[model samples]
Target: MHNDVEEILFSKEDISRKVKELGEKISKDYNRDDEVVVVGVLKGANVFMADLIREIDIPVYIDFMAVSSYGYSTESSGIVRILKDLDLEIEGKHVLIIEDIIDTGLTLKYLTDNLKSRNIKSLKICTLLDKPKRRKCDLNIDYIGFEIPDKFIVGYGIDYGEKYRNLPYVASLKEETYK
Candidate 1:
């Protein structure tokens, strides 16, 4: 895996610090609310979701939503479908959408819209990485850890062909290996 990595972008410490910061801000923003619900996009956001939830010292709830936007590819299909939906109703609840990365913006957009239609009191996105270079939809990400270039990164719960998500840190994959 080291041989295939071109560069180590985000070390484990760096990510941990950022996640803590983001959690602090989120806790502040939702302090007045009765129920603060965090909905994490599945698989990739799984690790971040766990870490972020622990950082918040306030009372909060967590849920998962699995979205299928891309399948072992960098390009998005411009369609969003739910592989797994949230079990709890977020109607009239403060909702935070946690994601691993925001690339095309399609998935997040779709997610926000769906949540909005459900009468959630508020909806905002929090992503670890913001890849504006590849965004296809008009985007706004509330909490962002890093603004990264257009690179296929795997680790910290991100993946390629369902591989590399368990790496301790974030690393850019070599093009030759995937192409």
Candidate 2:
């Protein structure tokens, strides 16, 4: 897995520190009586969400939603599909959407719009990586750990063809590796 990487972007230590920082900020901002629910976008965000929630020293709940916009492709198809919805009803709850990466932002926009209809008290997005250069839709991601370039990134819960997600650091894949 490491050999396929062209260059390491964020080391394991780097990601850990960033997650801790984001968690502390979230803990401080949403430190209230209202229940704070961390909604993680499945598969890609599994590792990030797991590490982030531990840093948060508040009573919060966790839920997973499996969404698909890219299937067997690195680029999004512009259409978002919810494979699995949240089990908990978030109406009037403080909802925080956690994601692994924000590339085109179309899927996240669609998701946020859908969640907004639930009449939640508050809604925000926290993404581990942001590719602003590739953004096609408008999005307000409250917590961003890294603003990365538009590249084929893998590792640290991100993947190429569902591989490399177990790697501890973020890395750019070699062009030949994908081809």
Candidate 3:
């Protein structure tokens, strides 16, 4: 799997440090009395959310939503589908959405809109990676670990055709591997 990577974009230590910083900022921004409901966009954000929540000092309730815009393809379809919904009721609660990466921003925009209609008190977004060049919609990301260029990246819970998610660092895959 190492040979398949074109280059390592972020080491595990880099990611760890950034995640800890983001967590601390998040912990300080929200009131300690308010229990934030952290919503992780599954499969991809699973690893990031796990590490991020550990660094947070305030109380939090965790949940996951599996929304798909990309199937086996490297590019998004632009159409979002909710494979799984939250089990917890988020009405009037402070909500935070954790994402592995933000590419076109379509899926997250759709999700944010959907969640806003649920009567949540507030909604904020935190992404481990942001690809602003590929964005098709405007998004206000409250916490960003890194701003990455447009590339097919996989590792640390990000995957290509469900592979490479177990890798501890972020890397760009060799073109031939995905093509």
Candidate 4:
């Protein structure tokens, strides 16, 4: 028997269901034989992007972008830099930024602007989790998996000091965990 989870906020089933729903929406929005390129932020977004890409039908390509906002803090450093860029050129291709989470939106805003400057045919944002309270920029997310509270959560590709990404579901970290 499987052990009960300590705090499974968004279960695996929930995640799967949401991804399918978002996929359908995206498919309708981007109707074409050629699939849009889905770019995932590094580390935390790896798992979420893997699952989301499978759910999304059409001939899609995948790539990873590694970025760092803060070296050792939860707060944004207000500067975003790409540690790694797409192996596939994004010019003239429909691009969807698949992200694990959107907190302050600084990183995402920076990324979207950068991609726009590349002259892509289309650009959109798709995030599995949204933390509205922390959003610092005006943005629109084409496909959103879940809208969560401002609480600091770990698991389901989120982490606390680089831990808890392996958890099958999301959970708000214990108050004392960050203390």
* Every model's TM-score: 0.96, 0.98, 0.98, 0.92
Candidate 4 regions with alpha-carbon error over 4 angstroms = 1-6
Rank all candidate structures by their lDDT, best first, as comma-separated numbers.
3, 2, 1, 4
- In the predicted model 3, the residue pairs found to clash are none
State each candidate's clash count: 0, 0, 0, 0
TM-score of 2: 0.98
lDDT string, candidate 3, 49-167, tens digits: 99999999999999999999998988899999999999999999999999999999999999999999999999999999999999999999998999999899999999999999999
After superposing candidate 2 on the true structure, give the runs of residues whose Cα lies further than 4 Å from its correct spot.
none
- Number of clashing residue pairs, candidate 4: 0
Model 3, residue 34: what's the lDDT? 91
The lDDT per prediction is: 0.88, 0.93, 0.95, 0.82
Name the candidate, 1 or 3, with the larger TM-score value: 3
Candidate 2 lDDT by residue in tens digits, 55-124: 9998998999999899888779999999999999898899999999999999899999999999999999
Which of the two, 3 or 4, has more TM-score?
Answer: 3
- Candidate 1 regions exceeding 4 Å error are none
The candidate, 2 or 4, that scores higher on lDDT is: 2
